[model samples]
Target: MAHRTRPLNLAVPALAVLLLALVLAPLAAVGWRGAGLSLGPADWSAVRFSVTQALLSSLFSTLLAIPVARALARRRFPGRGLLITLMGAPFLLPAVVAVLGLLAIFGRSGLLNSALQALSLPPISIYGLHGVVLAHIFLNLPLATRMILQGWLAIPAERIRLAQSLGFGPAETFRHLEAPMLREVLPGVALVIMVVCLTSFAVVITLGGGPKATTIELAIYQAVRFEFDLGRAAALAGVQVAVGAVAALAAWTFARPAGFGAGLDRGLPLSAPGGWRRGADSVALLAATLFLTLPLIAVFLRGLPGLADLPASVLPAASRSVLVALTSAALTTGIALTLALAAASRPRPLIEAAATLPLATSGLVLGTGLFLLIQPFTTPMTLALPITILVNCALSLPYLYRILLPETRALHADYGRLADSLSLTGWPRLRWLVLPRLARPLGFGAGVAAALSMGDLGVIALFAGESQATLPLVVAQLTGAYRMEAAASAALILVTLSFALFWACDAGGRRAAA
Candidate 1:
């Protein structure tokens, strides 16, 4: 039996080591390359802006989501399930696409501005610090709402019954049952959004620029692309790594589990007060739905006309993106599954850390470090796609690992003894036991990874030469050149491809599981 398991044991650690190397090696290169460099005033400004915007974005996203989530938790309106599903779309929506959507509604000549102009009011600018915050909120509010709603759902129905038995009013109910969940969940949600915004590149680059609005990620890009300052870029990357690590650690430390005991799986609903509260909840739902969906509708509507006149570069760029997305999805799924399976058998901090450490590093930071590491030997452009693939895998691995770990652990707990008794080792075990059991999460994770890669505009921008551009890059290029119609067209294609890849992988997994 030991002989049969020896290969599995060895493979787990070997894979862990490779993952650690992938994450740490580039960081080491960054540190070594920027050993003596000091950040200038501009770099300091970038750091400040990054931290400030991230905090503000997180605060607003969490605060705004509370009412929306509470409404969803208690309200059983029609289309409620569909609305919940819609929340996930913005999270998967490409940063470039979301920015374009925002521009369509809020830009100088966009719908809102047009209305203002018709009333003879001054037009608003969707560029600078405020724009950055608005865009972040737009992208992250849904995520915050979803997380909080899950917290609301996880509160055992018995608790709601107890509160109702006591004749608790809405305020009393919130004071006792709901607020505690928010206390437990909000910190984590805010921190997650903060970390996400801290590492934001595409959004900041598109909507927020200049010295006042630039984030560390943007400054790193400027250092590499515009200034050709590798040392400065490395220094900025190191700062980013520090900030990300600190935020991640804070999230882990602060996010305590709610000690709400379990209840029988009853389908009791929370107290949904009527009168003004009902009206308010309806308003919240309506506002949230519009805020989330309008940009997507605008993207479709604007892009519809330009579809027949897409730039020649869009098709080829999209093909490159699909290739990258598929490849990244495969690699991420394989690595995430291995790590999850290994961690399920025992507590492997090294494996777990390797799986998550990428969260503490942005794509541009990884790209910068990789560029520095690779430049001494060859041009970074020569290996752009491969590096992008690797970075996407690293970035996407954490999500898949998180998704798979719980299921993997549950599987092991339920079937490990039986599998061992039967000597279900090697390929047969995986084929008959593991794969069959874990197909759904594996599919969903792969879909997420694919969609994310499809919409990625980060590392590729740093490394891609003209010929190697992806769809997101193509869209950004078109937007940059003031080709709004073409950019919208390419962005629409990018969104379609991303969602399709996600659906295909996810559906395939669901079918296999069935």
Candidate 2:
């Protein structure tokens, strides 16, 4: 007991402390400055706008996610596996990539507009409140779908079979059985989306042409940093953080990192309903597919034509992104493994909670903290590549912890007694037993970290000087400079590279687990 339990307790907390310190830096900055800070009406307005847009985005995305998740859970179809994988893509898809893809399709010169011009109809506007919501749904719909399907997985097969035998129709089963699971899981999906929207910068920046549409995050950048109104920027940060914290708390409350799904029997055909329900599910799923995929399709179509116009700058920018991704992956994996190992035992509600804090605190926020932290010790913070990597490490930790903690908990719960009985402990137990058992999830954790790092725009945006620019940052720069074609090409390459990297890492982990 002493040998096995003591090391586990000591290590987990130590690792957790390191991870927590990094996440706390942002809150610490604002609080360290003091509570007497005042936000003007403008700052309050940004908060109100943030909440409104995020609510709209979350409500619409979740409502849309339901039918698709049900179809994926309730119906058998070809290409289902591929669709589920794509549903998880936004978790790694950089905000910049989605923004560029959206602009090509929805922008005035974009496909929809071109079609509108040909038919002499009023073109759809892609800037303002509508654009922010559009981009949010584009990123979140698939995520919410995946989460709901996972909830569907929680319904016992026997429970499902019994429900059918009792003559409960599909509608009844969904209402009684699936509805509860949705109730349970909806908070998690909504909370995740809300925090994401609160921290929104890139979405608002690219799409926000007018003052009315600005988010607190974008407003902060304009007011304090770019506009050089340090007082207003500081004021906005206080309001933003307060609002973000409230949303963060809500997210934490609804945080079922491990969620409940209704029921699914893999590859088994679900009982079908006639007419309206079936027709509705099919139609809704189709709309979601098109809504999510069309812009991405446009990225390829519009960007490919301009591939020849890809800046000579791309080769170097892409090169730097790859280096950053590789380094961030390795570093993120190391931190994940260490903290995961530390949290392997203990009741880690706090550490687990801390893991997700970075989700609320944007890369821009963290980068700002890191910039302030390092400024006394360094020149233009972007020049310090090592600090940028550290920011990436912090940014990627939440996904890594989420991926690793579940498996870690299971590993310890199931294996701890066995190892303690054997008097096996520390590296011996971990190497010989626990590590072997958890290889697949740990690798998945690593892959997730790497993929997210590859796509991250937050820290990189702040630290990416021309000399140190990452792919996502370079893509943003191109779009801003109106080198739209080059931006699109870079967006495609960035997305492809991130997916490939995740796949390779995850495959290796799975192979190792096997």
Candidate 3:
């Protein structure tokens, strides 16, 4: 027992210490500085606005997902797989690019407005609370649909077979089967979307249009950049974390593993509902596809024309972003593997929590702490890319850990005794057994980390000088300057690079596994 556990004892403690210094210490800095901070009316307003929008965004996203998810589950259309794949595209999408795409369709001279004008009706605005909610819905609806669809898919064929044999109609099947599944799924979906919208900065900053639409994250940025008020920024960070913790706890309490039963390859053959029900499904599917696909098409169309006039800065920024993303992918994968291995060897709550703690800490808040921490020793601008790399590593850890943990446990459970009996331990066991078994998930986690880091705007915005900026930051700068053509071109480049990296890594993993 002593020999078997020795490595884990050392590795787990070391990981915990690293997380403390790198992740927790910085958050503590925020809490420490904001200890005496007090909120004014404006600060309170930001809080109210942040909570209100998040609630509305999550509510709408989850409610809208029910019908869409149900339609996708039962109906096997020609392009069904492609549409499902596209659902995940929004996750890898850079926020700035999404904003540009949305504007092309919803802006004053955009499709809807033009149609309204042609009909002699007043063109509506896309720059207030509704605008923010609209953007959130566009972004999160896919996520909610995917989650609910996963739940639908997990329902056993036997239960479905029973329902069909009992001559249950659509209403009865829904009441008995689908509604229960949704009840199990929607809470977690809402919680996830709520947390995402809670810390949303780029979307609100761009679409918010003014102070009245500001979220807590935007308020923090304002305090730091305009007021130079660390106290106010820290105070807002505190509120953000408090709100995130409450939501997270609620999710943890209510959340169950969505996995119910393994799919048996053959689907449950149920009778299709006809008439208006079918039409409603068709409308839902068509509207969703057009809404999501149009913006991407616009980005490509708008960007193609501007590529010839691309700026010189785009290349350098792209290079820097690639470098940071690669480095962060390596760092995050390494840390997540180490922590996952340690926990798999022997579970420790503190070590596990430390890995996930960053999820609750906003990226801008982490950048702010790092800025304060390193400002005394050297120029923050000089260390901008490195700091960004580190923050990305911290932010990506939780996802990587989630991917690795289950795989690690399964590997150990299956092979631990056998490996020990064969006297295969330490590096050889991991190299031969664990690594081979885990390559696919590891590669997937690395890809996700890479893509996420490639498009991250939070840390870079805080630390970037005029000369040092990532691709996302560069795109945002162009948009701020109203250089729409140049911005669209840069966004295309950003999206391409992000997707390419993810594809290469994910495909490589599949090849290795095969």
lDDT string, candidate 1, 1-514, tens digits: 8998899899888998898888899999888888889999989999999999999999999999998998999999789999999989987899999999999999877899999999999999989989999999999999999999888988998898889999999999999998888888899999989989999989998988898999999998989998899999998899899999999899888766677877788656798899999999999999999898888888899999999988999999999999999999999999999889889978998898899888889899989999999998999999999999999999999999999999999999999999999999888999999999999999999999999999998999999988999999999989878788889999999999999999999999999999
Model 3's TM-score against the true structure: 0.95
Q: What is the lDDT of residue 451 in candidate 2?
A: 78
lDDT of each: 0.92, 0.76, 0.85
Ranking by TM-score: 1, 3, 2
RMSD in Å for model 1:
1.2
Model 2 spans with C-alpha error above 4 angstroms: 1-12, 255-270, 348-360, 382-384, 413-431
- Residue 275, model 2: lDDT of 83
Where model 3 places Cα greater than 4 Å from the true spot, the runs are: 1-8, 257-270
Candidate 2 residue lDDT tens string, 141-198: 9888988787776677767777788999877887877787788888888887887787
Worst 10 residues of 1 by lDDT: 254-263
Tens-digit lDDT string for candidate 3 (127-246): 889988988998999998898888887787887888888999999988888888778889988998998888787788788846588877888888877788888888888888898878
Q: Name the regions of candidate 1 deviating beyond 4 angstroms.
A: none
N/CA/C clash count, model 1: 0
Question: Could you tell me every candidate's TM-score relative to the true structure?
Answer: 0.98, 0.89, 0.95
